[model samples]
Target: MARIIHALSEIAQDYDALFCDLWGCVHDGVRALPEAVAALQDYRANGGSVVLVTNAPRQRASVQRQIEELGVPADAWDSIATSGDAARAALFTGAVGRKVWFVGQPHDEVFFEPMKLIEDPVAIERVALDEAEGIVCCGPFDPHAHPDEMRPQLEAAKARGLPLLCANPDVVVDRGESREWCAGALADLYEHMGGRSLYFGKPHAPIYDLARRRLTALEKDIPDARILCVGDGIATDVKGALGEDLDSIFIAGGLAAAETKTEKDPDPDALHAYLQREKIAPTYAMGKLR
Candidate 1:
C-alpha cells in the first residue's frame, strides 16, 4: 500500500533529485498551481536538483517559455528535458527519410527546423500518405476533441507502411478544468490500424534516458534510486519511473483527481484501486504536490 501524504515535504529529503512532470503536477494548462510551485521551490531551496521532464512536443526552450508564461518561477527547476528534444535527436541520427508528412498544431513546426526536412502540406490535408517518406506526429491537430478526423490519414499511412515518429507519449493531459488528447492517443489509433510508430517520450526509455543525462549534468553521482519522479499520470509519469527503475510520487489531485478524489480530499481507497487497475505502485501518493 502507498503512503498517503498531504505534501511533498514529507518525502523531499529522501531523494537527491526530482524527475518532475510538467503539465499536471506542476501546473494546469492555463496557470501554475501555487502550492505545487511553492513545493518545488522549497525542494530546490533545500539543495535538491529538479529536472522538469515533460512529454511536451516542443523543445526545452519553448517549454521553458511556456512555463514562465504560466507563472512558474525560474528557480523552481534546475533544468528541463523534453520528449521533443529526444525525438529530434533520434530522427537526426536515424535512417528515416527527409520528406515527411507532419501532423500537429502550428506550434509543432519548430520540431522540423533541425531536421531540414520537407513537409508535404497537401499530403497531410489530402491523406496522400505515399507522398512522404515518413510521418512526424507532435500531437493531435486539435487536442480538445477526439482524433476521429485523423482516421483516414492513419489508414492511408498504414496502407503505405509508413513509419510514424510520435514525440509525446502522453495520451491525455489536464487543461484547467478539461482533459485533452495528446500525440500518444493518435499514435495508439495509428497502431490499432496496423501502422508502426516510434515513440520518444514517457513510458519509453529515450525520454527517461535524456532526463537522467540532464540530471547527471546538474548533480553528479545522483543514482537512480536517489531520484524520485513526481507526477499525476499513471501510464506516463508513474509507469515511466518504474520503467527507468526510479522511485515515484503519485499526485492524486492532478489528472486522476476526478476519479480518485472525494469532495476536496484524495480518497485513498479510490486512488489505490485506480493504481491497482493500472498495475503501477508509486512509492508515495499525495493529494497535491504541496
Candidate 2:
C-alpha cells in the first residue's frame, strides 16, 4: 500500500529531481495550486531540480506562458518538457503522411510550425476524411461538444484506415472543479472503432524519455531511480513512471479526487480499492502535492 502523506516535505530528500505534472498537480485548469507551487519551490530551494512535464497539446513556449499567467513562479522549475515537443520530433521522422487532417482547437495550430522546417514539409489540410492520408489529433475540435457528437468524423476517418497521431494522451483532466474530455478520449473511441491511434504522451515512453533527457540536461548524470514523478492521473502519470522505472507520487486531490477521497482527506479504504482495481502501485499517495 502507498503511504499517505500531507506534504512533499516528508519525502523531499528521497529524490534528486522531480518530473512534475503541470495540469492537475501544479494547477487546476484555471489557477495555480499555492501549496503545490510552494512544494516545488521548496524542493528546488533544497538543491533538487524540478522539470515541468506536461501532455499539453501546445508547445513549450505556449505552455510556459499559460503557467506564468496562472501565477506559477518562474523559480519553481528548472526546465519544461511537453508531449508536443516529442510529437514534433516524431513528425520530423517522415513516418507519418505529408498531407494530414488536422483535428483540434485552432490555437493548437502551433503544432504544425516545425513541419515547415523539413525539406518536404507535412502539409496540414482540414479536408474531408476521404481526402486525407493521415490524421493528427491534438484534442477536441469543440471542447463543449460531447463524444457522441464527435463520432461521425471519427467513423469516417476509421473507414479510410488513416493513422491518428495523438499529441496529448490524457483522456480527461480536472478543470477547476469539473472534469473535461481530452484527445485520449477521442483516441480511445477511434481505437474502439478499429482505427489506429498513435499516442505521444504519458503512459507512453516518448514523453517520459523526453522529460528524462530534459532533466539530465539540467542536472548532469541523474539516474532514473533518483527522479520522482508526481501527478494525479493514474493511467498517465503513475503508469508512465512505472513504465520508465521511476518512482511516482500520486496526488489524490486532483483528477481522481472524486473517487479517492472523502471530503478533503483520502478515504483509505476507497483509495485502496480504487488503486487495486486499477492495478497500479504508486510509491506514495498524498491528499495534495503540498
Candidate 3:
C-alpha cells in the first residue's frame, strides 16, 4: 500500500512497446477517456508500438470498428487482438467438432460462428443438452434481473457433465455507467458445480499468444526489454501481461475504482491491498492511464 502514482510520460522512456487495455482503462462503456486516448497517441507518437488487447468476445475487426466509433485513432496502435479471435481458434483446433451449447447474447454468437452452432435455447429446450458436446458461455445476459435467470441453465449444463467453454470469462464489465455481470459469472457457477471451463480469453496464454502473433506479423522485431503493458483488471490485463512476461502498469481507475472513494486518485492503500489479495504485482500502478 505505497499510495504512490507514477508519472506516465516519465515511464514512457523505459518501454518501447505498450499493451493497452480497453473498457475500464480507456472508456467507461459510453464514451472514451480523452486523457487515456491521448496517452496512447502520445506513446505511439514517440515511436513506441502499441497493441490494444481486449477481453471483448467479438472479433478484432468488430472491436476495432467499435473503437474507431469511440473517437480512438485507428492508427494509434500497430495492431489489435481480441478474445473472440482466440476463442474461434480454439473452436477450430482445440475443441474441433464438439457440439457446443452456447449461453450468451445473440451478437456474441459471432464468436461461435466457427463452431457448429446449436441455436436451441438451453433454458427452454431440454433436447439441446442431448445434442451438446460442450457448453460455450459468453455473456450472462443483457440485464441480469435475477440470479436464477442463468442458474437453472448453468445447473443443467453442469448436471450433464458437459465441459464449458467461456469465450469472455470476464465476471463483470463497466457497461456505460454501470457494472453488469458478464459471461464469467455463469462459468464460475458451472465450475463450482464440478464443471470444467476452458477459458479462451484474457489472463490466458492463448489470448496473449495471439496478441504476440499480431505483433510479430508487423515485420518488426519487438524489443522485449522495452515493452510494457497498461491495463485495468488484474485478472485479465495485469495477469495477462505477467503471464506473457511483460512489465505491466495497472490502471485502477476503472472497475477497481469502485473499491475506493475518490475517482481521481482512488485509495492507493486499498488498491494495493486488493492487488495483493488477487496475487497480482504490477511493475507500475496508476489511478488512470492519463
Candidate 4:
C-alpha cells in the first residue's frame, strides 16, 4: 500500500538524507544509470546528504573505484558503507575465528587487508576448509552456477559445526542483462543443510549501524523519521528499512521488474499484488531511482 512516485524529488525534501543501494538502483553492475545518477545529484545539490549503503562484499575504497569505472561520479554520493566493512569488523573480532576458509573471487581478496578500525584485532589466516575453524563467504566461486552445487562443501562444514560469515546476503544480481548468483545463495543452502550462517548486510542490524556511522561522519545527525532508504531488493532493502523503522522507496524496475510489470513505471495493480505477496509495505514505490 505504498504511494507510487514518478521521481525521487517528489519526496526528497521530506528526508535529510538517503541510505541508497548501489548495484541495481544507481548502476546495473556493468554501467551507470544516467537518470538515477542525475536524480541523486539533484538531491545532493539541494543540500541533502546521500550515503551509498551497499551490500557489496568489498571495502568502501575498492567499491568506490569499481563504481567510478562503471561511470558513477563522485558527486552522486557523500560516503559509502559496505557489507564487507561490517563483516570485516566482525571477522577481525574473531566472530568466525582466526583461521577460516575463504570463499569468494580473487577480487574480493582486498577484504582481508588490514584496517585501523579495530584497536585489538585478531590475526586472521586463510586455511583449507577441513583444517579451518570457520568459513568466510564473500560470494560463490562461480556466480552462474546454482546454490546446490555448493552442497558437498556445505555438508562437510555442517557436520564439522563451522560457522559461516556471509559477507553479501544478496541471492542474485544482474550484471547487465545476465543474472548471476551471489554469496547469500550459498549461505541459504548452508542454513537449509543445518549449518549456521551469520549475516551482516541488509535486513540485518550491522550494516545499517555502519551506514549511520558513515552518515554521522558527515556531521549530519539525521533522525530516523527524516531518513529514507532506496533500493531494489525487496527482501534486503525494503525489508531492512522496515526493520530499522525508516521510510523506504522501492525501485521496482530492478529485481521485481517482471513481477511488478515495470516498464517506465510499475503497473499499479501488479505492483500492489507483488508487495501483497511479499508482505512488505514500503513507504513509496517507483519504477526506477529517477
Which candidate number maximizes TM-score?
4
Give model 4's TM-score versus the native structure: 0.99
lDDT tens readout by residue for model 2, 1-290: 88888788989898999999999889998999898999999999999999898999877888999999999999999999898878877766654576778889888989877644357654445566678888888888876677677788888888888898889999998788677888888889899989999988998998888888887777556888889999998999999999999999998887888799635668999899989999999999998888
How good is model 3 by TM-score? 0.88
184-207 per-residue lDDT for model 3 (tens digits): 777777788788888877788887
- Going through the candidates in order, what is the number of backbone clashes in each? 1, 1, 1, 0
**Tens digit of lDDT per residue, candidate 1, span 75-123?**
8999999999888876666524566788899988887655333233222
**Native-referenced Cα lDDT, model 2:** 0.85
Give the runs in model 1 whose Cα sits over 4 Å from its true position. 115-128, 262-264
TM-score of each: 0.93, 0.95, 0.88, 0.99
lDDT of each: 0.84, 0.85, 0.74, 0.95
What's the lDDT for residue 172 in model 3?
84
Candidate 3's C-alpha runs over 4 A off are: 1-3, 94-96, 114-127, 146-148
Write model 4 residue lDDT over 205-273, tens digit each, in one string. Answer: 999999999988999888999999999999999999999999999999999999999999999999999
Clashing pairs in 4: none
Off by over 4 Å in 4: none
Worst 10-residue stretch by lDDT in candidate 2? 115-124
Q: Which rank order by lDDT, best down to worst?
A: 4, 2, 1, 3
